[model samples]
Target: MIVKTSRPAARLAALVLPLAALAGMGTAAQADDWTPTSAIEFIAPANPGGGWDTLVRTTSRVIQEEGLADQNFAAINVPGGGGAVAWAQIARDTGNPHKLFATSPPIILVPLAGTSQYDHTNFTPIARLITDYSIVLVPRDSEYQDLNDLFDAIRENASLSVGGGSAPGSMDHISIAGVASAAGLEAADVNYIAFSGGGEAMTNLMGGHVEAVITGAGEAAGQLGPDSEVRALGVSAPERLGGPLADIPTYQEQGIDYTFDIWRGVMGTPDMPEEAVAYYEELFAQMLETDGWADARDQLGWIDAYQNSEEFGAFLDEQKEEFSEVLSELGLIR
Candidate 1:
């Protein structure tokens, strides 16, 4: 290697070396980028027409219309154990990024009630999308004009059962419990019947199996009209919502000190890669900004409450603490 190269030849060689280095960098960038290679299984941990099912279907439709992701989103229903069945299934698929399930307070409430083996800690929080209110419903022919009237009857007649779409001590159970307790009835004494979904609860109410039902307001939309069979006794909202729900009274307006929000979000399997979480976080953020989501929110009566994955995780922690205190006071957190 004694021969010395000319200055021009040396410069050309140096330029070629830099070009090869740039190509290698490009390859690494491509390798780092992650996206779903197949259709995604968007699980709705509940029966069809339930809140979770509606959320998944609506979200997938809007995302598709907006061209948010290349892969298709298929909504799968797995109803049981107040979301325990879906939680167990997702838990089994550890580290899977393709699987995502719609979540509400049940994600925390179910496990707190000893119905689920896993809690929010067992999954990857993707994004908190919206907040829906809980509504107290009664037969249009029922004499219960308000929360007080309903709770009074429940107190007078111990056999009266207030049914809900969640398991006992879960979302719907705790909702009516909080209000009934506030109305001078023992929270533990409030008779709450469990149904598989809101639709089934509504059916039983018509069949006279239960006196009343509480579910996400969005889930009761179709049953809240002049021609419908159900009447809204009160809603768990600080103020009355707009649109078809505007006429419905709030617990506060009726002189009860109670409010509950059904926070809906999405979660992935345990140990999902940070890359997948990041991708979904961004995708949802963008989806919320689109006109399609706005329209759907208004129609569904969902309030805008978007939180990214990290923020959502922290929010869940706060919710766990607050709910622990509430459920403990109600004697349900055993």
Candidate 2:
């Protein structure tokens, strides 16, 4: 099971900061010691229209519209090896502060799974922006009524399988494992099947290949309407999400003690200058207060989870250790 940790003070303060304070919080960044002189290359280490790409495009537009930065932020897509290709490029460009990229849990998971040579330690953390959650789904006509019922059924029938988008021991595996363990099932005993992506996982669910599907909340949003083919059993969010996800109850609300955070953030090349890091950190803290960012976050089903560099780096270390524990339980630790 995943051990939950407390949020950093910086993250807590970021959530309650008033608009006026947020506006002036970046006064320290006005120094000429470090600031982007040219257009900042904002990279999404995935194909266009994916989560990271959308975040990059949306962040660029909001920053440009809000007049947050002096230099324009240019969105770039560098897709390959599920982010390894772009990560390699960033690793080679040490100290390049102008090039920033969108990041999420895979920064840690991929490396621990032995897919990527470089990990979060190879990059300079800028700030964590928002957090998304995972959801458990079953076919609309399935007999299971909720997460507990499903776990009970799995217990009675050991052959049942839960499918997910990520490879075994990745986000999907860990998400399902976390809840299964919380539900009184052994993490290693749960039958998990991996698919290419969430779409495929959902498709297989509809086809009756898998007993259920567990995926990111936003990833499976569209198929979760009143008349949709799939219904949510429970969400891995601490609280219920907004919009289409608002109706879905969280695991805690359902008497299960579990929550999985799919945090999204920004990071720079390795050894990024401290001054440059400060500039971006302050810039993102300001972005969290923008009306555009607020709207984008709402539409994306994300929660405010801003964490400055120091807080983010510490959080990453904690997350790595936590994930390592869960991965070990599943015997897939690399």
Candidate 3:
């Protein structure tokens, strides 16, 4: 689930100051001191075709297209255990400056759910690149017309099942649970069925086997169009997105007073050199400034929410604590 907590502007500036200094935005010597000496390994902890895979591949493509990096980027898939397998490998490569991976809410959620031994604290945070929100959908002919309609029905009928792409207590489930709680429903009591992926969940919804499905807004976009079988009830974004998704209203717009964003970023092996972290921070900052990255982000329905290493690290800690409370509330803490 995506939650946006307000950080004071002064606090945010303080968090960013060290990263700006390391990037040589306020200095010069540091940026010249660090550059990858060989091909960089970009790891996607999930199988190809999933969100992590898309992020790693798209970032590599954008960097190469924009000439943002001098070294070749090798996108590697290390799929397993909801990122646990890759995190284990990364832990074994501590201090390896040439290795980095795509990261998101799962990095925090899965571990807290006791499915993994490694968490965000095991890695050196590089930067947070983009944010995406969850989309709640139902079959085109379903009776639920909006988020309230769906939640009201679920509340009235405890047996009604909701489905999501992630594991029971992970991203997709947590997303809807958050909204359910905000809508005055008992989040822990909501029947959530887990699917292997959003595609599978969507299939079940289209087949009339599930009451509703929650998945990434980008993933939902692929199935929603002029002649689609799924109808989006509400998105977790605070505001409406552009392009084909502009017509979909946010939960806030529908008076739900809820928001969630799935943040994706890059992080390195533990004990990675400060210089390497600084190098990636500067490289990603440059990448975000390029037209190539902007175009890629827009096409993928990603919102730009860049945060340097220090800032991203702080954000991860806050998320860990926030999610702990949420999971505990939902009785999913392991």
Candidate 4:
């Protein structure tokens, strides 16, 4: 099950402010000695070892090592509702100047699906760090030759089971249904199993519990190693990827008009102190420039797509509408 919650730590470490802030378009006092002296909490809206947790942890490490903040940092897992729990907390923490919440495409999708209580307008966009492409994976010796081959099977047998690492109405499941719908298969005809994290879903796929798996390319790279025979038939991007997994063809290249770009970003409460918001944005900017960040990206096979508060907010609004339409067409949304 994909478990998630919005509960924060019962006891916080402290309420602190540090000197030495970064430059940005904010009040002069907000930039003055802008450092966090307390243990900064980065809430991952999913269980440990999943995409959200991994991204937040890696980012926290990069920020700390680069001295982006003056004090040590911490991250907590608050998984559920495809990130509803974490998002809600961030939205409620309007007065909290110390907390930051990790966000992505699913953050937008959750509210549009009516699974989340709050919408994108509830939070303050901090920064957009990376964008990931989704991939279609099958076991090493599956008879399917390519994306076309797999969809052909699904079309022929509408009950063909598919798996993903998100909830019923979330991105992972939506990608599979989107492709199936485009290929003349009823979205509801496909069987999809939701796993709490990619690590767990990958296990089921390898164990033959599901016929195929849909996950981000970055999450699948670990299992798609050179020694492993697991094949990525299609990437949900405009073109092919460029890296160790560059050889894989996109769904578009396979004549399937589909795309799913997972944008990972950060957010704070709607009324979080201006100084606190600036502090986080500056830290994220610094993190993007670190060698550690680059190493993590390569290890995860993720693409670099960074945006600040303003740009990220606009992107979020656009995606919310775009994905909501897709979900509604599939009958996953009202």
Candidate 5:
């Protein structure tokens, strides 16, 4: 016998057809589509008033002010574990396509030091925005004349107590270790003290809390500003930086062939939609074209080293390998 379908069933089939079509359209829109329907959440992965926080906020502000995104981008602070919390959060939000995390060598260094749970593979790289070099800073009237004098002191006493703006196992400490190892001292012999940020570290230095500061150039640059009291001994770059810090010498120039540039970049959760990554890269590229970005870069004394996903991925891989050895030598890891 033949059975006839009811009107309700027919109506349900009609509704299902439109829903399926809409779902297909949504999927298509998500794949290879660059439209941003929502404001991207730029996770700073650090506390306010620090380097990473400032970097993300500046980028987000420029993006919103310059109309780079459909809506205004916002930054959320998730500081802890030396960026492990934010890394895990972004890693779990795979395919979100709306979230981005501000990151640098600290992201990898923390994990490699076994202090953080999240690793580099947990996220997708969007783009590397700029490069921040490390600097050796000392009190203005200190007896240590230059990089050589500091190394000579370090050679005499491995426990010279070099303070930094980051935590004990973070980038600041790692960079100090790298410098010491380059200066004929074992990484494990170097004494490193952690400071929350450079400003506080400088205060501590002036108060005689620490002998010297191995911090970011951006942080030490202001020390050489007009009416400043401290002086930068040397920078960790292939060559000298421009502007107010231009006259500063490089460690390599002073017979130390070593340089470290921390590439600050944006990252997304694993499996993030390709379209979203591309959209962010494009928006960031556009953001870089603005005077705001240039002003921020110069103001921060950052080296503009822009690179997209693949290049950043390769760079990250190379960095991880390099840090792995450094960490091992420092006894931070096996």
Candidate 6:
């Protein structure tokens, strides 16, 4: 029972205008007046070792090592409901200046799927920090040499299961469905299996329980090696990435016009004071400029796509609308 509706361009335009205005109104001097006097609670809305956890932990470490924050930062993991649990807790603490959470696409997608009561609109956007692309993977010994080979099989056999870390209508599933729709297949026809995390999904792929996996490029990189038992068929980036991911080809390069990026950011509880929002916006902007942040970015295979609170709010609005279209096409929205 998926939901569907047509969203007018005007609706999105209306959403962005106010956010853009809010972003433009904040001042540096106002931000300085709201510095935290005690340890700041940085919430990672997922378990340790996952993307959300990695983001807050890394950013906190960089902020500390670079002497960017006067107060000690503490990262707390509140894992459940694919971030709904943590988001609910944050909602209950609305207007708290010291609490912030790492967030991403699920903040938009999950709520739209009606699996959560809260959405991006429920939080105060602080900053968008980095972006990570998705990679399609298959077992090393499998016959599929590329994404086309894999898609061909799925097209022929609709039940051929594809695995992902998040739920049915979330990031990894959406990435594959977007490509499938572009490649002339019914997006709903492709069977997608949701695992608790990328590591678990990879385990199922290695065990030959699923034909393919779509996960974050960084997570895929950690599992791939010269002698590893799996291979990356394609990445959901417009262009090939460098370093360890250099050899992998983008879907477009492989003749498919599909691209997706998992952008990670921080958001505070709702009703957060304007000064508090201003403070985090400035803090994250400075953190992005540090050498320590750059090193972590490279190590994690993340690309810098920093946006302050207002810009991030507008981006989230656009993303919500874009995801609505994609999910509707895939029959995941109702």
State which candidate, 1 or 4, has the greater TM-score: 1
lDDT by residue for model 3 (1-334), tens: 9977667876898889888776766346654578899999999886665577778888999999989889998999887676788899999998999999999898999899988888999999999999988988998889989999988888788899998766667888788899988888888868999765565677788887889998878656666788998889998988898766888999988888889999889999999988888889999999999999888788778889999999999999999999999899888887
**Which stretch of 10 consecutive residues in model 1 shows the poorest summed lDDT?**
26-35
- Worst-scoring 10-residue span by lDDT in model 6: 24-33
RMSD, one per candidate, in order = 4.0, 13.0, 12.2, 13.1, 6.2, 13.1
Residue-by-residue lDDT tens digits, candidate 5, 1-334: 9999999999999999999999999987776577767777888776665567777888988887777777767888887666776787788787887788888888788887776778778888899998889988888888898888987887788767888767667798888788777877777777888765555566778888788988778646655875777878889989988877898899899888788887788888897777777877887888889988888788778877888987898999999998888777678773
Q: Please list the C-alpha lDDT of all candidates, in the order they appear.
A: 0.91, 0.84, 0.86, 0.79, 0.80, 0.87
Model 2 lDDT on a 0 to 1 scale: 0.84
- Point out where model 1 deviates above 4 Å: 1-32
Higher-scoring candidate on TM-score, 3 or 5: 5
Candidate 5 segments exceeding 4 Å error: 1-34, 197-200
**Highest lDDT against the true fold, candidate:** 1
Q: Who wins the TM-score comparison?
A: 1
Please provide, for model 4 over 238-314, each residue's C-alpha lDDT reduced to its tens digit, 9 standing for 90 to 100: 88776667788888888788787888888877777767767777778878888988987887778778888888889
Summed backbone clashes in each candidate are: 0, 0, 2, 6, 0, 5
Residue 249, model 2: Cα distance from true site in angstroms: 1.8
Q: Which ten-residue region of model 2 has the weakest summed lDDT?
A: 24-33
- Residue 146: error of model 4 in Å? 1.5
Off by over 4 Å in 4: 1-27
Clashing pairs in 1: none
lDDT of 6 by residue, 179-248 (tens): 9888888888789998766767878898989999888886567667798888999999889887678889
Q: What is candidate 1's lDDT per residue for 74-122, written digit by digit as tens?
A: 9999999889998998999999889999999988998998888899999
